[model samples]
Target: MSILTIHPKDEAQETALKTILDGFAVRYEIEPDETEYLMSSKANEIALDKSIKQAEEGDVVKIALDDLWK
Candidate 1:
């Protein structure tokens, strides 16, 4: 289970990416949650401090489709 952070600004792009992911013919799930640690991380931190400030600290869960096939 890998955690992938989707920046709020690239939401549209993320959605598009998800669409592409769906084409992979794999079973996956998206769970929405919230967290504060993202507020202090630099990994894939595509938003600015001021923008992150307004980030309601949330998460979108993605499970590997390969696991479901097993």
Candidate 2:
């Protein structure tokens, strides 16, 4: 099992990663960054903190298309 930390800005990239990983049955989790920063409402720092903490516990993975071919 592994955890992949991806910036939400590149959502398309993440989707591509999911597809490649799915083919191989590689377990993974997505860690989302703070979203309230973009909103005008109150901050959601707690959610951001929790996501970061979850990421720290799992193994990190870098998604590369070349890896899929190997």
Candidate 3:
């Protein structure tokens, strides 16, 4: 058996796909969002936590708006 993972653009698309699948009696499972994958592992969770803490403490430097691309 093969499985297909889908990333819908918006809620409407997600609902439409679910509706189609349901109409066809296909079994499907809903998983967590992208953020869940970001912190899926312990090391990743720690790194994200540290980054969030730094941002909350205002330890980040601000770059000029025009210099963003350069």
Better of 1 and 3 by TM-score: 3
Report lDDT per candidate: 0.61, 0.67, 0.96
Clashes of each: 2, 0, 0
lDDT of each residue in 1-70, candidate 1, tens digit only: 7756555457788688688778986455665544455545675354655456665454434569888677
Worst 10 residues of 2 by lDDT: 33-42
> Model 3, range 1-70, lDDT digits (tens) per residue?
9999999999999999999999999999999888899889999999999999999999998999999999
Q: List the residue pairs that clash in candidate 3.
A: none
If both were scored by lDDT, which would come out higher, candidate 2 or candidate 3? Answer: 3
lDDT for model 3 comes to: 0.96
Kindly provide the TM-score of model 3 when superposed on the true structure, using C-alpha atoms: 0.58
* Clash count in backbone of candidate 2: 0
Model 3: ten consecutive residues of lowest lDDT: 31-40
What's each prediction's TM-score?
A: 0.31, 0.38, 0.58
Q: Residue 39 deviation, candidate 2, in Å?
A: 8.0
What ordering of candidates by TM-score runs from best to worst?
Answer: 3, 2, 1
For candidate 2, the per-residue lDDT at 30 reads: 62
lDDT score for residue 6 of model 3: 95
Error of 2 at 4 (Å): 6.0
